[model samples]
Target chain A: MEQPEVAVAAGDTSDPLTGLRAVSSLRVLVESYELRQVEAALRAGMSWQEIADALGVTRQAVHKKYARRIDPTIAVPRRNRT
Target chain B: MSRLTDAVVLSQQIVVTATEEAYRVGHAELELDDLLVALTAVGGPAGDVLRSLGVTVDRARSAVAQVHADRLARAGVPAPPAQPRTLPRTGGGLPWSPRADRVLTAGQWDLRLVDDRRILRDLVREPSGFVAEVLAVLGLDAEGVLTALDAWVPTATAPSGALFSPDPRPWRTVTRRGWVPAAPAEVWSLVTDPARRTAWDPWYSAVEERADGVLAATLVGEAEGAKPVPPGFERQEVVPVAREEGRLVEWELRRPDRPGGAPVQRLAVALTPSGGGTRVDLTVRWLGVGGWRAVVGLLLRPVARLAWGQMLLAKHAGIARALR
Candidate 1:
């Protein structure tokens, strides 16, 4: 299994899709980083409402997304399909 | 090596409590919902996320109850009288369902830190499980939960306890250091000056010198909407109990609520020269509070430490400004 090519060369601006691809990849990285920070904040004993307040979202939205995912008793089984 | 393990085990106490909570909810077997409630109760990354999603302990309990009610209605059976959940001692000390046990065990494998968040991350990936049922109750499905979990990257920094502890204590303690780009003498001068100290001390609103050479200070509690301070916190007095010229200063911070019998906190600040600047070391220790208040104080120690750290950082910034 080969890793997908993501790195954009410094001077390679010839390919129109290259910039878009790089931007898309960067967006994923940023989202991952933000999620990681929220996890860190949670580990640091931050509350969901507190985290939501920081992220400018409703508490329910945050909980709905993360409540089960961050639970210690349940392991989300990996699936092949979305 | 044992000490490290002990620290990790001590931190993992929340898991045990979560397990207990699962049992209390009348669940014959510990499920993911119970675990989620436990995490929310213990307060960590998972708890925070749950709160953000509007899943509080009360809300989770109600949701579980509602699910039970719906099931009973569907079956046309009347609800039985609620009974206390007995800690299941059948499986050694753990009462968790077999699958839950396996997941928890896997979380701790390979020396990985098994926390509520870590366990939940693994559980969310499973399409069909008890967690899925709990998700459905919350108006969420397994697929949606998994998608969100997939997007999340677990990158929480090591526990703040791990930051300063070569050997972590059973209790929480915070140690912080700050460097100011100013001479030790200059920094110390400002630090020792009672008037300037109040300006940067996050907890102190005012500092006045008494006729007996003891400095009496009014201490502020945490900022509004932050962690709630103990009642009568504002009445506390921060009196300088010990001092060493341009080197160290110690204060006996007495809580106002306790008055004559209040616990005294010894806060020591040390200044040392480093690379044409000064490094400040602050140590805060709570003393002589026994019984229940001792437990409360222990819990509040971290909050107190945070306040002190913020004060010192501000003080350092002031010093930087003054020197310029």
Candidate 2:
């Protein structure tokens, strides 16, 4: 797979207008509350490793799924909450 | 260095496992079933997304893999990497046609190798700027196509416009819910009356009237708490649908917000008196094509679907509560 600069965004950011465009569709909407819950978990300081375990995935998998989302400035504590 | 890494090489592609329909409720992937589902979801955009990305795809993905074996092998991926492989065939049982075979050779779209686990493509339709243009970037290994994710894009037409043209983008999906035990007009009385409509609906604010019909004035409620009601998810033109009065009672939605948001509905509800009760036949008239429409459609569809289920169940319950 070729590397695309703007292309790097698909897996992460979707155009704000992309969601704005969906407003016209009947059954479709932007992301759901369930997904927001996923984001909320991240904000609550839950590690992707722990989240993966709860979601039945490997730590690497969870981190891969959400690592891009982690704001580096937040200084997430790596220590396991358990 | 293109900020690209040797580690970014398409390590291997794995065949996606088939799962239940509910499994794919949130995400879009590129498996045979998923691709088929996507083709159905995006309708036109499925092909357009591929063509826009310059990736050659078809209703038959197996053959698509064979023709792209050189590229797949270069990335160290197999056709399916797993079971249930359906190879592609030509008119004479060949792999692919001569012209059909040329989609990948310097096509209009660019497929940039992202990493061992991703493949990115530039798909242009509505041109969502840098954020929305990139489609899936999957990884390939000894297996075939890894997890190919559909853009899960918003479906409203125009960069921004009303969804009133086409069928509801994502929400307001009208399925043929069977009729209940009541007359169409009788049920219409329960559903159409503004006060009564409010009685039965949690989302509908109230019912108003224009020259053509009565409007349900209510905020389309989200599931518990959903963000920005899904596309085509908003409500208006909501009424106890009746093509022929007293015979069928149903409901329809019009976006009036997004381009292509107008619904081409084909559902009619009927009430047949039976055993002292009414039996209703709720049928779908038609649904607009999915695709760019559905990207936004899914968001709205959830609430539309959920609200329908809730409205009906609640409507019945509310009516029952009122009757008692």
Candidate 3:
């Protein structure tokens, strides 16, 4: 890959434009990583409560966000839980 | 019966795959790099060409990450962790970026069919330069890729008429069953005899047995309220491949003017005695073309199946009328 002609100093967060772009990129990266790990956990037959405990969040919060996204066949059942 | 051609089906698959690629990386809008990555996954001539040149999905995904990392590096921010290999199933649509839309619709200006290969060409010639940059990162160039694609010949070598066999895997089969007010032997005689078929079958205007034991028929194209003959097809030659006396008859239909190795449509009519009448089952297996069309067929299968169902309904009605 061809390198850009000019490179900013390492760990320099001085520039506002660069800082904002980096923030946006990092947010997208984190969201994608979270979705992937959640999918892997579901496929591995882990229940929602287990995943929530690992992420330090409530089971209901985790299930509400990812239940629709995950395939129903692979999703671990939530017995008698709202 | 439907106007959805193989090109249209293939294009739809490409766009859907590209959308998934965008969604996999948390992109709100689909871009050229997403399309390039998708081309590696959708099985078609373009995908085959890319794979032949060593552009596998894993390689393309890594190269795409490298491009994103390089862009972020210019901003003094370190690259994030690599994306996961398994893509998430996106529920809704992602709007296409302007550059991506432009590359997709560029083929409409030309008279050429907008197949995957055409889309690949348009991607190479896109003025936005994003796809070209990705190609550069992949150790390839537009000119080299195009040359390789142009020279690439598909390896489908199934012999002419060999696709007409009893194997129902590749072909799309449409079946309709109805009770005709006649005995099984009587219905079988009428269906097996070409002269009787012309009187009852709405699809055939005239049918005659040739010296080679095949039946040559003039197709009824949009006449007498019959279903229109598929475009580019004028005549149908039926070569009987299987027969059980007074029980079943299977004929493989081929277009006389079509090129050799083109898909042959198979028509099988099975008769059985039921409730003092003949239960006739009509099956039409169509477009058994083995290469890229098969891939496209898998994508738009429901559309083709529905169209075939409509035609079969009309034909079965005609058969019942004649039997009465």
Against the true structure, what is every candidate's RMSD?
A: 21.0, 21.7, 19.3
Scored by lDDT, the top model is: 3
Per-prediction DockQ comes to: 0.01, 0.03, 0.11
Cα lDDT tens digits for candidate 2, B1-324: 121322211111011111111122222112222223222212132333333333432322343223233333333323232222121110001122122123212232333533212222221121332212112222221112212334434231211111122343443433322213233456657654555666645455445665667463545443322235665546566544444445544556554555575655533445554322333333344354666976776667656655454344333433322221
Candidate 3's displacement at residue A53, Å, is 26
On a 0 to 100 scale, what is the lDDT of residue B53 in model 3?
79
* Poorest stretch of ten by lDDT in candidate 3 chain B: B156-165
Best-to-worst order by TM-score is 3, 1, 2
Q: What count of clashes does model 2 give?
A: 93
B7-65 per-residue lDDT for model 1 (tens digits): 35323544555555654544434555566665555434455556556666667766755
Candidate 2 is graded, for docking, as: incorrect
Locate the minimum summed-lDDT window of 10 residues in model 2 chain B: B9-18
Give the 10-residue window scoring lowest on summed lDDT in candidate 1 chain B.
Answer: B158-167
The alpha-carbon deviation from the true structure for residue B158 of candidate 1, after best TM-score superposition, in angstroms, is 13
What's the lDDT for residue B138 in model 3?
A: 88
Q: How do the residues B1-324 of candidate 3 rate in per-residue lDDT, one tens digit apiece?
A: 122453554565567667766766756467777888777765457877887778877688888787667656665556555543443211245677787888788756555654477777888888755566678998999999999878877553221122123664656677755545466777877888877876567677789999998999888755433456776577778899888777778898888788685676888887766544555667889655668888897888899887876566556555654553
Better of 2 and 3 by lDDT: 3
